[model samples]
Target: MSFYKKDNSDYLEQAFYSLQGQTLPADEIILIQDGQVGADLENIVKKWSQRLPIRLFVNRENIGLGMSLKKGLELCSYEFVARMDSDDICHPERFEHQYNFLKSHPEIAVVGSWIAEFSETIEKISNYRKLPSDSEELFFFAKKRCPLNHPTVMYRKSDINKVGSYFNFRFQQDYHLWGRLLNSGFRIANIPKSLVYMRVDERLFNRRGGIRYFQIETQVQKTFLDIGFINKLEFIRNYIIRGCIRLIPNSLRKNFYETFLR
Candidate 1:
């Protein structure tokens, strides 16, 4: 998991607590300290070290999500690596289900579950996001969109490395990786269970908008086209749709997303 300066101390503790309470306990909690997150957060990490088997790595300079994850993967000891957000809450049975599933289906390279998006607190779940269960369907879905919930995924490290790991995409790095994995014939699936409670708010829509994200959307669409994951028609259609979405008002975009897209 990766955390930066903006992550809250209480939320970080809650996240660690959730990991600590997992039914199938984690072998090692590989926490990436993305740049300097201050002394208070360090104290939180130090406190959790005694309870959770944390493998902490500190980054002297902030490298963002893609590079940070790439750096973290090299430090991982196990074959299967589960992705967790520093502030999100994972259900106690999440790792148990994903681990068992991966063990049983050795051919599948990645597995992710649905997520309940909450605002304020986990109990205040405001939205839900679900993905296809079948590998073929999910692969087709990846041609136009991200195939998995980033934080809810458990992926094979070797498979991820084979596809060049996580590239330095400023935005939607997981989407780009999923596109590459699917294009390379790596299988993936979803459990159809909401195993993670992801925190989000209206600010999410704001982040998705603005000039930077709009530019990032264009770059992502172009990346997919260059990778052969999407054809000319899909490239044009996706770029236009995402650009318009980014250009729209945040409240309107959120309503449109929750109403039709989600």
Candidate 2:
């Protein structure tokens, strides 16, 4: 996994601790400092490396998360790659469960699990679970919005390479990448289990983030249209639904999403 740090060193440490307690730990942990300069982060890195094989990648200038992930993937020596954000915590059996599933089932190129949301207080924000398991169900949902949780996904290195690396400098690289992967005839499957804790709030969808998401959604819709993933009438339905959701008040939007999108 690749981690980028800033003043959120505390949460970063917590994320690492969660990793340390994993039932099946990663062979290597790649930590990237995306131009975050602080004594706290350095100390945390030093402290964690004593027990785990942590490789540190430092950026002289700030690069976006997409670039950070690409860099991490470039340096990864493993066949199966899993993603974990700096603020999220993975379940103790996350890697073990995903690895075992992938090992037993060779057809799925990418796999993600259900996710739960948490606030800064660590309280459950609300319901945030999804239940589309195979490619057909996942594509059914993806036609409308991102059905995969970015941080809870694991992909085979060869499959990612076949599709191409994460989009460079894009606003919603994960969302766009999923679209392209589906477009290319790859299969996606869900583990049917909650495996990670995600943090969500108003800041996650402020003006800038809102605009970014809209751009991604538009691009995804266009891609869907291009490949006949959905008819014009269905596209119109999804476009209006997504547009209206984007316009709702942030609090109401969160509730609407938890109720309907999942």
Q: Using TM-score, give the best candidate's number.
A: 1
lDDT of each: 0.90, 0.79
Clashes within 3 Å, all models in order? 0, 0
- Residue 83 CA displacement from its true place in model 2, Å: 0.5
List pairs with backbone clashes in candidate 2.
Answer: none
**Tens-digit per-residue lDDT, 1-262, candidate 2:** 5555454778778889889999998999877778866788788889988988899989888787888888888888898989988888888999999999889889888899998877764455555667687878888777777768889998898888786778763556787778778878888889888898877766764532255566666676776678777679878887787777776677777667667766
Candidate 2 regions exceeding 4 Å error are 5-7, 120-125, 169-171, 205-209, 227-231
lDDT of model 1 at position 47 = 99
Candidate 2: worst-modelled 10 consecutive residues by lDDT: 205-214
Clashing pairs for model 1 are none
The local distance difference test score of model 1 is 0.90
